[model samples]
Target: MTRSPATPLPPPKARRRLRETAALTQTQLATRVGVTPGIVRAWESGRTTPRGRKREAYARLLKTLAEEEAARQAKQKQQEQQEQQEQQEHQKPDEKQESAPAPVPKLEPESKPEPQSDAKPAPEPEPEPRPESAPVALTPAQAFDALYAFSAPALVRQTFLLTGRREQARESVERAFQAAWERWPEVARDRDPVGWVRATAYEYALSPWQRFRPRHRHPEPPPADPGDRTLLNTLLRLPPRHRRTLVLYDGVGLDLPETAAETEASTPATANRLLHAREAVAGRLPALADPQVLHRRLTELASNERLRAAEPPAVRRGGERRARLRTRAAIAFTVALIGTTALTARTAPTHYEPPVSPGQAVRGVPHRVAPGALSDEELELRQKLRDQMQDGPERLLPRLE
Candidate 1:
């Protein structure tokens, strides 16, 4: 069997983003990836993609470079800040001397206060001995119930931000919860079930199936408070991965590593995405560029009732049945296809030969016969030719005598 030709990898943005996130110049990336700078440019331009192991090497190297670059930047920033602090201290000797700690005043000779006889202070109530019984471990069902109640709204909100559609957000969140419910036995023991659910919901929200779904009859987006609309618009405008990372990082309050886990990306990549996302948001809302200012804004965005997964699921408790049906249908279809193909092959012939009529020449073939073989017309013509040849010599000789 002939193999299908290998197609190029997807999304020119992937290689470009990696290169940018790695903080590598084109020439540097080329040298590191063992390609010419022109080839790297072509990869970024979508004119070509690295094939086979080179593609894997490219991805691995980019991640490695990004981590290294992040470390370098952190070290550099720390050194610069330390040097600046030292310079400021050295430059301000007079100010430092002038700002010396004030001297403590000597205590006055001790004078004891007299107790008031009329006002007896009420005895402080003895602290109740807290019950020391180890807290009861919750059953998985109870744990899931609590998790679902507490995290569902925020999960739905983050998912809505990622997907930009409330209906899809609700669906994704519901699916995530349903999956959690099925796996509750194990998830109850998880360190962060809420994170697990939120991450799962994000994945569901980004499902490719969502792209093919009908968009008609969407519930209208409630009017956003104009105060937050600018941030909302900026978030929505970002690429899905970046937008999802931002929501998980700032909006969901996950730190870089936690956000990376949620986004199924490395910490460095998540940080890079978060940086770009913050910059995009800061471009629109300059106040958010500062860490203090952005923290306050993100706090408001995180708790904004408007961002709450306010809408309840349209339906619940049906996914399992639907999943089973889909599974069975897929198996049946595969079996049927295989059976039909096998049966047809068994019934087919190895080769084909169609009947031909006499005197009809094959399309591209000339008719030929053995020399001894002749038709009646050919025989009669040959005999006449022989008789003429035999009579010719005697008739001519008599005429001459």
Candidate 2:
């Protein structure tokens, strides 16, 4: 049996509470419902009211989360009760001993009680040993905050270098962090969570579909730094692979193998790309012709104040993710069609027999006609006709009888 979907109530507080209970970051919730995090944040803050399917989906997801949270809370309460009961069971013997009456001292005829001093006191209870406490789990907020604090700035800078667009750089970093916020528990446990964020930001910044996007208008700065501008322009103009490879190797200081893993290419392929990239840059800029000079210049550019991020912007990316998918599918279909046509043409038999010329009809002497003997029936008919011509018609009629 199918369960009815939950209808989201119109109250903003109600939705916010549902999201809190579900432990979904606004970004995660937005992603689940196909909206921007800013939109989700607005909805939660009562700044906007989603309508139509958005409203319906918002309600349904919240209701489902509320149900799940209720179930989880109920389960936790049951577990706590069971744990208390077990503790009580373990303490039963001691509790029973403590509750029992102290053994009575029997008095004998010759027995004499010792003389009581000025101080007479009843027996006191011995203190019980303390039990060890369980370790506490870190709250989601603390985990997420810590990760964002340590990683976001670096991700923004790295992405800015990769994309050369300040707004796009910020978008990429935020998107990466949003993903991290959603899976914080696992991220917190990771060996290099920062590395994961960095790689994600790189991929986001280097998204192929970003090419067709309209450029962001930047307010003119006081004056451009010649070296930084030149370097950025050079990096931006190189093919994406070469540019990204150089940044990862020279900018981020990732080793060849690390660069390969992050870029999703083989070590040898990364090596080749980096090598060619260095040559490409050298060809363009005489100052970067030497390897040592190139590294120093790259490091200086990475350290520039212009490369640092100011604050995370409230924008969204990944419109390009779907567009890229469509482009790849279209390109693949076209390639397949071309390949099939080429293969067919290569292997198929040719049908081009040159047309015979009009005057060539007399060619080959028109293959001489050969005479042949007539059939026996024709011969007999001829002989009968000849006899008919010699003899009278009455003689031929009598023979028929």
Candidate 3:
């Protein structure tokens, strides 16, 4: 009997992408392939490969998923093209109407010319200026700079409202922009780039570890105005999450859903936080019970503080510097690790050597003892031998035949 050849599979990354695109879980894929989820995970992570029947099943499944994803993308593209065509079709009449000239007023033959006014006619009004053309597309760096310029100052102010510390706020904004610069492509393509930076800044400003920072351990000076000071103090008193929600919703004028989304909280949770924050503020100052009034006060409080962000170019340079430093540090660490591993491999013993056992006392062997006194019989025999030896010399004459 002959066996059929195994199907070819995509790369690990593509395999994972195919599964995600199909909305299939690792466990589900594992079950279909008759393997454990762990094995499937290992396969997707490029740690292991499947073989025999499982390999063929996984390959076939991925191929189908890829086809489906491609088809979906094609359909979406076609729909977008159709929509664009429809929009152009709708715009044609408006363009024609705008381009057409007005009919000239017809003059009757019986009409008589009215007498000219003696006074100078009113000066003709200047025609309104035409709208400017659409702007040219910006390069990535230019776009990043524009976004930073437009949002940084306002974001610093908003972050100040959240943290009530001008320096911390500035630092947070700088860090967020640095991160955005590091991921400029992603941020630029995001639907709301401002929101992305805002969220990052908020997260940095509200991080619990900030308290451990030596610079942040001390409190910053309050705003100059008593009202501003009081408002700032009240805002600082709220929990970080609530404070963030309040600032996003009231200070920045974001809508409830947007605030919730930015804060990563449910709408109801965000509303509750906002309500609690407002109640706390109003309790401290009776005048801020109204949302509009609270918003105005928050804005006024933030604006009253003097906070500045680093220049965009400086921020971008800083981000790049940080990235290079991190990369270098990682390389150093990896080199050290590899060196240590190689050293160990070179110096390690090749064969096992059994350990030597410790010495133990023998069971039956008698220990040596010092001789004390010779017995009397042994002493007498020694004396007799001394006397007999002297006589044995006379008796030692040669014996004749």
lDDT of 2 at 377: 98
Ordering by lDDT: 3, 2, 1
Clashing pairs in model 2, backbone N/Cα/C closer than 3 A: 8-59
**What tens-digit string does per-residue lDDT give for candidate 3 at 195-249?**
8788888889899998899986677777888888888888889998888888888
**Top candidate (lDDT):** 3
Cα lDDT listed for each candidate: 0.69, 0.72, 0.83
Evaluated at residue 330, the lDDT of candidate 1 is 100
Ranking by TM-score: 3, 1, 2
Cα-based TM-score, every candidate = 0.51, 0.42, 0.60
Tens digits of lDDT, candidate 1, 1-401: 99655443434445556666666677898888788877776565433458876787776776676577779899999999999999988887564345667899998898888988998899999999988999898865566666777888767666766666667777788887777766666556555677667767777788777767667345446436776666666777898898887776666666775565445455577889989988998888887887567656655654574544432232224556666788999999999999999999999888997868557667877678557878899999999797786645655444553
User: What is the TM-score (0 to 1) of candidate 1?
Assistant: 0.51
- Looking at candidate 1, what is the lDDT of residue 229? 60
TM-score of 3: 0.60
Question: Better model by lDDT, 1 or 2?
Answer: 2
**Candidate 2 structure quality by residue, lDDT tens digits, 191-257:** 5678767877777788887776766444324216887888778787888888888888887788885
Candidate 2 Cα lDDT to native: 0.72
Of candidate 1, the 10-residue stretch with the lowest lDDT total is: 308-317
